[model samples]
Target chain A: EPEVTQTPSHQVTQMGQEVILRCVPISNHLYFYWYRQILGQKVEFLVSFYNNEISEKSEIFDDQFSVERPDGSNFTLKIRSTKLEDSAMYFCASRPPGLATFTGELFFGEGSRLTVL
Target chain B: EDQVTQSPEALRLQEGESSSLNCSYTVSGLRGLFWYRQDPGKGPEFLFTLYSAGEEKEKERLKATLTKKESFLHITAPKPEDSATYLCAVLVAGGGADGLTFGKGTHLIIQP
Candidate 1:
């Protein structure tokens, strides 16, 4: 089955450095999202995108965070000036546009582990 | 804010053991409740989605039930491969936020 794919399985960066995490959602999927999981914690929503624009975002998705679909097949999340607390496993997910059989499914990528030093 | 609480924090079961995991939730309005499985260092894998009260769905060795207030994931004759952290999330209706509010998750260990 086709699955979401993310790049840079793991990344380590200085506290003040910038980081960009990339993802390619399933070919037929239309809704894209970014979520993060701090070590041993819950998965928290960051943002959702559709129609090539941001649909919604959470408080955690502050000014430091930004997402873009720079190309037809790529979705990217950039973190400006990472902090120690920014370290976490960031996941990219997508779902096909709502249809008769839709029951709220979000397919996810393997995730990118970010470690801030 | 939407909230989801899963219990107990962890569970350990011997092979072929049957058990149930609980997911309690509070949302402004229910859109759907979702279940996912996560292995260490991996993103969550979607398992099931229950859209309304009294609805149920099943997969091999797994059955999920939903209610107005909570949901349950029952595992029958489970194998070690079934071991993983199970997460439950909620999507609120009319919230304009398609993002999910996830529970901390229940970590299950099935020993063969």
Candidate 2:
């Protein structure tokens, strides 16, 4: 089965440095999303993209965060400057649009673990 | 505000043992509920979707049931491979993009 894939399975960065997490969602999927899981915490939604634009974002997705689909298959999330709290596993997901009823079956990538020190 | 709460943060069962994990939530407008499994160091894999109250779905050894306020994931005669964190999430149609709100997961350990 085709699956979403992410690059840099693990990333380590300085507290004030920048980091960009990349993902390649399933080719045919139309909607893309980003979510994060802090160690020992629930996975939290960051943002969603469709039609090459941001559809929605959470409070955690503040000015420091940005997402881009620079190419047909790549979806990336960039954090201007990392913080200790930024340490977490970031996952990318995608899904087809317009199902008769919403089921919430978002396909996810393996995830990129980010460690900030 | 929407909130999701899962009970029994962790569970350990011997192989072939059966048990259920609970996921409860409060959403402004409940559109659907989802169940996922995540192994250590991997992303969540979709397992089942419950769209409304009284709906149920199953696959292999796993069965999911939903009610207005909560959902349950029952694992029957589970094997060691069935051990993983079971996550539950709810989608709110009238809310933000993707419309998802998740609860902390229930970590299940099946020992062979």
Candidate 3:
């Protein structure tokens, strides 16, 4: 089965440095998303992207955060300045067409663990 | 706000044992309910999607049922490989753009 793939399985960055996480969603998928899970915590939605634009975002996805589909296959999330609280596992997901509702099933990547110090 | 609450934060079952995990939600308009399994240091793996109340889906030894206010994931004759954290999430009608509102998840351990 085809699956979502993310790069840099793990990353360590300084508190004020920039960090970017990359994902390559399923080739035919139309909707892409970014979510984060703090250690031992529930997964939290960050943002959703479709048609090269942001569909929605959460409070956690403030000005410091940005997402880009620079190419047909790559979806990237960039954080301008990392903070200690930003340490978490960032996951990328994609949804294929055909579901009646926008809330279709999602395929998630293994995730990228970000550690900010 | 959409919220999901999964009950019995943790559970342990002996091989061949059967049990259920519960996920209750409060949302404005229900679009879909989803179940996912997650292993340590990995992303969630989608299991099933319940679109409306009274809908149910099954896979192997696992069965998922949905009602108006809650959903249940039943594991029958479970084995050690069934051990993992089960996450339940809700997608409200107009809340699709924000993605899923996930619960804290239920940690299940099946011992062989």
Q: Can you list each candidate's DockQ?
A: 0.81, 0.75, 0.70
| Cα error, candidate 2, residue A107 (Å) | 1.1
Candidate 2, residues A1-117, lDDT tens digits: the string is 999999899999999999999999999998999999999999999999989999999899999999999998899999999999999999999997777565688999999999999
Error of 3 at A25 (Å): 0.9
Question: Share of real contacts kept by model 1?
Answer: 0.87
Q: Candidate 3 versus the native: TM-score?
A: 0.96
Q: What is the lDDT of residue B78 in candidate 3?
A: 99
DockQ of predicted model 3? 0.70
lDDT of 2 by residue, B1-112 (tens): 8999998899999999999999999888887899999999899998998988999999999999999999999999999999899999988867445657888999999999
Candidates ranked by DockQ, best first? Answer: 1, 2, 3
Q: Alpha-carbon error at A42 in model 3, in Å? A: 0.4
Candidate 2 residues lying further than 4 Å off, grouped into runs, are A98-100
Chain A TM-scores, per candidate, are 0.96, 0.96, 0.97
Instruction: Give Cα distance to truth, residue B78, candidate 1, Å.
Output: 0.6
> What is the docking quality class of candidate 2?
medium
Q: What is the per-residue lDDT of model 1 for residues B26-103, given as tens digits with 9 covering 90 to 100?
A: 888988899999998788999999998999999999999998899999999999999999999998877476888899
A26-68 per-residue lDDT for model 1 (tens digits): 9888899999999989999999999999999999999999999
What is the RMSD of candidate 2?
A: 1.3
Residue A106 of model 2 has an lDDT of 90
State the lDDT of candidate 3 residue by residue for A2-112, as single tens digits. Answer: 999998999999999999999999999989999999998999999999889999898899999999999999999999999999999999999986765665478899999
* Pairs that clash in candidate 1: none
